[model samples]
Target chain A: MSSPERRTADGLERAQQLVRLKRYEQPDEGYFEGFLKEFQQRQRADLMQRSSRSLFCERLGTYLADFGGRRMLLAGGAACALALLFVRVAPEGQPVDAGFDAPRGEVTPVSAGPLFEGEIDLWEGMVVPAGDEEIDLPLFMVEPFDSRRAAGEPEIIEL
Target chain B: MADVKKRKPDEDRGLVERAKDGDTAAFDELVTKYSPKLYGLVYHMTSNHEDTNDLLQDIFAKAYRSLRRFRGRSAFYTWIYSISVNMTLNFLKKRNRHWKISLDDVDSAIEFDKEFIEQTSKTDPVRESNIHELQLRLNEAMMELSDDHRAVVTMFDIQGMPHNEIAKILKVSPGTVRSRLFYAHRQLQNHLEEFRR
Candidate 1:
C-alpha cells in the first residue's frame, strides 16, 4: 500500500493522463463556424427579452458614468444642499416686524404709562394706564391691558 | 513569442474599447476568437454537448452585457475565463445528476495524441472495446466530485491553468487550489481503480 502523499502523486499523474483523453472529444469543425451566428442570434433574443425600462436604465447608468454626467450630478447635489442650508439658516437672522410678525386674532394693542408714577398697591395689582384717565375698569379689562403692554403693543383697546 | 503574446492583448484591448463603445462588429470578432476555447472549457466540465452549447451562449451574452463594467484590471482572457467557470459551476449545482450525457464524436486526430498511444499500448488487448466505456467512466468519476474539486481539476488538469490563475479565478489562495487538486486526484483515482486493474 502506498503512503497517502505517494498515492496522491500517482493519482495526479494518472489523472493527467485521463485529462489528455478529454481533448479527443470535439464538436464538428462546422460547429465553430456557426457559433458566432448563433451567439448573435441569442444576443438579439436577449435584447428583445429585456423590458424597455431596464434598457433605458442601463443606458442611463452608462451615461451617468461618464465625466460630464458625473460632474453634473455632483453640482446638482451641491446646489440642493446649499439651498436647504439657506432655507434653514435664513429665518433665524431675519429682523422681527411688529405689525407683521405679531399674532393677529383676538388681541389688541396697549401702551405703558410712566413706571414710577403708576399705583403699586399690595391688594391691587400695578396700574399703568396709557393716559392720566383713571377710568374705573373691571379687573378682566385691566388684565387685557397689562397683557397687551407685556406683548409690546403701542396702545391698549377693547377687542 | 513574447512579442506575439504582448501584441494579442493590445489587439484585444482595442476590440474591447470598440465593443465598449457599442460596436457589435468588434464584439463579434471577440466571440469568434474565444468561443471555441470557451466551448472546450464548458463541455469538459458539463460532459454534455447541448448543455455546453447553451452555457457557452449564455456566458458570451453575459460577457457582452457586462463589458461596460470591465476595467481591464485583468487580461480579457482571464476575465472571460472567470465568468465561464463561475456560470458553469452555478449551472452544475442546479442540474440533476441523473441527466444523461450528450457527448459529441471524439476527434479522429486523438489517435495521434501521445497519451492516447501510451494508453492504447498498455491496454491493447481491451483498448478497442474499452475506450468508449473508459471515457464514460472518466466523466462519471468527474461528476462524482464536489463542484469545487471538479472545478480545480478541470482548470488545472484539463485546461492546464496554473495554480495562481485558478486561485484568482476562484478567489482562493494558491495553497487552497493545490489542496483541492490533491484531494480531487485521490478521489478520481479511487473511482477509476478498475481501469488500473
Candidate 2:
C-alpha cells in the first residue's frame, strides 16, 4: 500500500492539493455572504424535502428483516401471488351458475328468472336475484348435480 | 495544530456521547461541523450536487438512526463518514451509469485549479483551453472509478482525511485503507494524465 505522498507528483495529488487549498481559499466577503445564504436556502429546502425517516435505514432494515438478501426472489414471489389472486378474484364476463353444484339436500336448480338476468357471486357460489321484488323459490327445489357433469351439459330454461 | 490535536479527542468523545443519548441538536451541530468535509468526500465521489446533497442527507439520517449501534468502536467522525461512504456507494450502485457528473458552480475545484494555474504559469496550453473542457475531463475521470476505490480516493486525495481515520470510518485496517487509496490514486492519476505536464 503506497502513501498519497508517493503520488505527490501525480496529477491526482495536484488536483487534491488544489481542492484542499480551495477550502481555506476564502471567497470574497460579498461572495461568502451570498454563498452562505444560498447554501442555507438549499439546506432548508433539502430539510423540507427529506423524509423525517431515513430511506437508507428503512430500506436496509426492511431488506434485512423481510427480504434477507432474497429481494428479487421475494419480490418476484409477491408479484406472482398478486397476479394469481387477480386472475382468480377478477370478475368474469359470464355469470356463474350457482345451482350447478348445490350441496346435497341443498337446491340443485336455483332460478333467478330469465337467462343471464342476475349476477352470481363466485365467492359463495350463489346466484343473486336481479331487478325489483324478491323471486320466491324453494331452497331445495332442484336436486344437486355434479358440477363437472352439469358443466358438460348446458341448461335449457323456459321463459 | 497542538490545540486542535488536544481538543479533537475530547470533542469527538463528547459528541459521540451526546449523539448516543438522542440529542438531535447535538447531532445537527456535528453535521454542521463535518458536512463541508463530508460534502467534499461525497461530491467528489458522486460528482453530482443533487445526488451528493441527497446522499449527504441520507448518510446523516442513517447515522442518526444507527447511533445506538455505533458502540464506540470508532470515533464519531469516522463512524459518520463510514455511514456516509457506504450510503453514497450504495446510491452509486443504484444510480444510472450513464448519468454524467453534474459539477457544482459554487465550489468547483476546477475554478480553483484555473486560478492556481493562471497565477503560477506563463503560457500553459493544456490548462489554457476553455476551463469547461478541463472540468469535463477531470469530472469524467472521477466518475470512472469503482465506488469503493472512489470513496477511498475521495476521502484521502480529495478531502485529505488520513488513512487511520479512513480505516476507522470504513471499519477496516489502515493497511486496507492505504491499499485502496494507493490503487485509487494510481487509477485517477492515469485518468487525469492529460492535465499533467
Give the DockQ (2 decimals) of all models. 0.25, 0.08
List, residue by residue over B1-197, the lDDT tens digit for candidate 1. Answer: 23223434445898999999989999999998888778878887887777899999999988998888788887788789899999998999889967664344334445566767676667533364556666777788878888889888877777667787778888899999999988888888888776652
Residue-wise C-alpha lDDT for candidate 1, range A1-159, written one tens digit per residue: 569777667666776676556755677669977888888887888789999999999878766665466688899999999979967776776854544666557756667764334553434554655568774545653332355556887765669
- The per-candidate count of clashes, in order, stands at 3, 1
lDDT, candidate 2, B79-157, per-residue tens: 6777788888888888887876554433444355555556434436454565556656666766787888877776665
Off by over 4 Å in 2: A1-159, B1-7, B19-22, B102-127
Best by lDDT: 1
**Evaluated with DockQ, which candidate comes out highest?**
1
Q: What is the lDDT of residue A9 in candidate 2?
A: 56
Q: List candidate 1 stretches off by more than 4 Å.
A: A1-8, A64-159, B1-11, B100-119, B122-129
Model 1 CA lDDT for position B61: 89
